[model samples]
Target: MHIVICSSIDFTPQIAQVAQGLTRLGHTVDIPLTSQQIIAGELTLEDYFAEKTNAGESARRKIEHDVIRSYFEKIKMADGILVLNFDKKGIANYIGGNTFLEMGFAHVLNKRIILYRPVPEMLYTDELLAFNPEVIDEDLALIR
Candidate 1:
């Protein structure tokens, strides 16, 4: 299976580990672009998120760089998307705005939705459940 990983950039390191597991299982994996850059030492986490400090600048950056659209393209070509939903901001199994959007894209595209953890308690919990994601609970063997 060809898989695209969706998660907060904070999980960059863990994403690499997950990619390795998927590879071991004979699956082709693609990590988030930002995470790849950070892991490659070409970009820093802080720098990638710096524009987020200003709402206007963030919006501009997203538009100018085609961030969302590019990810949508990746999702469109993938067989499935694996969400690495680790805890963040005191929320267990956190799924931030971008990851949520990516999940929605995969669902509408009829792509498999895999979650590394259980559904999180958030404003979008109901919507997340609506996606009917398959939870792996950190077991890569269960990816199918």
Candidate 2:
């Protein structure tokens, strides 16, 4: 199955590993450009975030908006979305705003929603429960 790996920029290394694992399992995987760049060492989290900081709020917002739109396009083309929900700020299975938006896009597109981890008791717990995402833990084969 064609799958798009979705996660925050902070998880780029993990995203690359997950993408590789999915590819090894014979699934086509799509990752964000920022993640790819980070994996290639063409970009770093420090530099990426610094660029956003230097660009100022308005320009940064535009860049983020464009990136989210691009992700929506990828989600529309994919068979499913594999969320790499690692812990953040003490929240296990954390799903940040961007990942949540990607999930919404995939859910609305009728694409499969696969979570690499269980749903966390976060602010969006109710909304995430409503989506009924497939919690795969480490068994990525369940992504199909």
Candidate 3:
């Protein structure tokens, strides 16, 4: 199965561990961003002044919207989604964050949902955690 590993880029080690487990079980995994990108400059917010100096605020907003839309299109292509654990900052406050939206989209589509965190603490709430969760099982049959 082609798995969409949805999680904050900061948790690369955790994602890699889960991905490795999935790979051993014959699944392909794809994560959105790298740990370096998250640490250096994850596009959490925009600077209107910077855009105003060049392409103007309107163009900047459009670009942001387009980028997010493109990402969702990519998520739609995945066979399943693996939601990781929230960091200390908490994923809840990051509502505009792409991870949350991708997870939500996957849920609505009724695709295979895999939760591969150390603990069951949720960033969204109880409603989001109602879906079936995947545990590490080497003998689990492949969906593909």
Candidate 4:
């Protein structure tokens, strides 16, 4: 299966590990760029901070628009989506924006929706359950 692994850019390591696992399972994976990544090739973190400190609101908005446009491009290429809610920070939070946007796009495109949060404790939370009550054990089977 072709899968698009989606999660926040700030959580790159977790997303990379999940992507590797999915690839090993014979699935093609496309990972989305993180927010910081738009300028990563051109600017260091310090440079971004410096720029943000000096740039006008209009410039920041333009940067955000570009990042969002790049995100849409990735969505167009995905077949199925995998939401990585497995957190490296030890804080049990829902999977981030990339995954949610992917989910919305997959829904519109009639693609498979596979929400995989590896932390079992977090999985049973009201937050996730509420976000997607239709998800059942059959979906969970895909992770293995």
The residue-by-residue lDDT of candidate 3 on 1-144, one tens digit each, is: 878777655556666677777788788876654332333464422333354357566456547557456556656787887777544455332222456677677877777776544334455555455555554332235334
Select the stronger candidate by TM-score from 1 and 4.
1
Using lDDT as the measure, the top candidate is 1
After superposition, the stretches of candidate 3 with alpha carbons farther than 4 Å from their true spots are: 34-67, 90-97, 118-123, 130-144
In the predicted model 1, the residue pairs found to clash are none
Model 4 per-residue lDDT at 88: 46
Query: Which pairs clash inside model 3?
Result: none
lDDT for residue 84 in candidate 3, whole number 0-100:
71
Q: Identify the superior model by lDDT, candidate 1 or candidate 2.
A: 1
Order the numbered candidates by lDDT, best leading: 1, 2, 3, 4
Choose 1 or 4, whichever is better by lDDT.
1
Candidate 4, 77-121: lDDT as tens digits: 766667666554565545554455566666667666566644234
TM-score of each: 0.91, 0.89, 0.57, 0.58
Error of 1 at 121 (Å): 0.6
lDDT of 1 by residue, 28-102 (tens): 998877788788998887876786686787577568878899999999999999999999999999999999999
lDDT of 1: 0.91
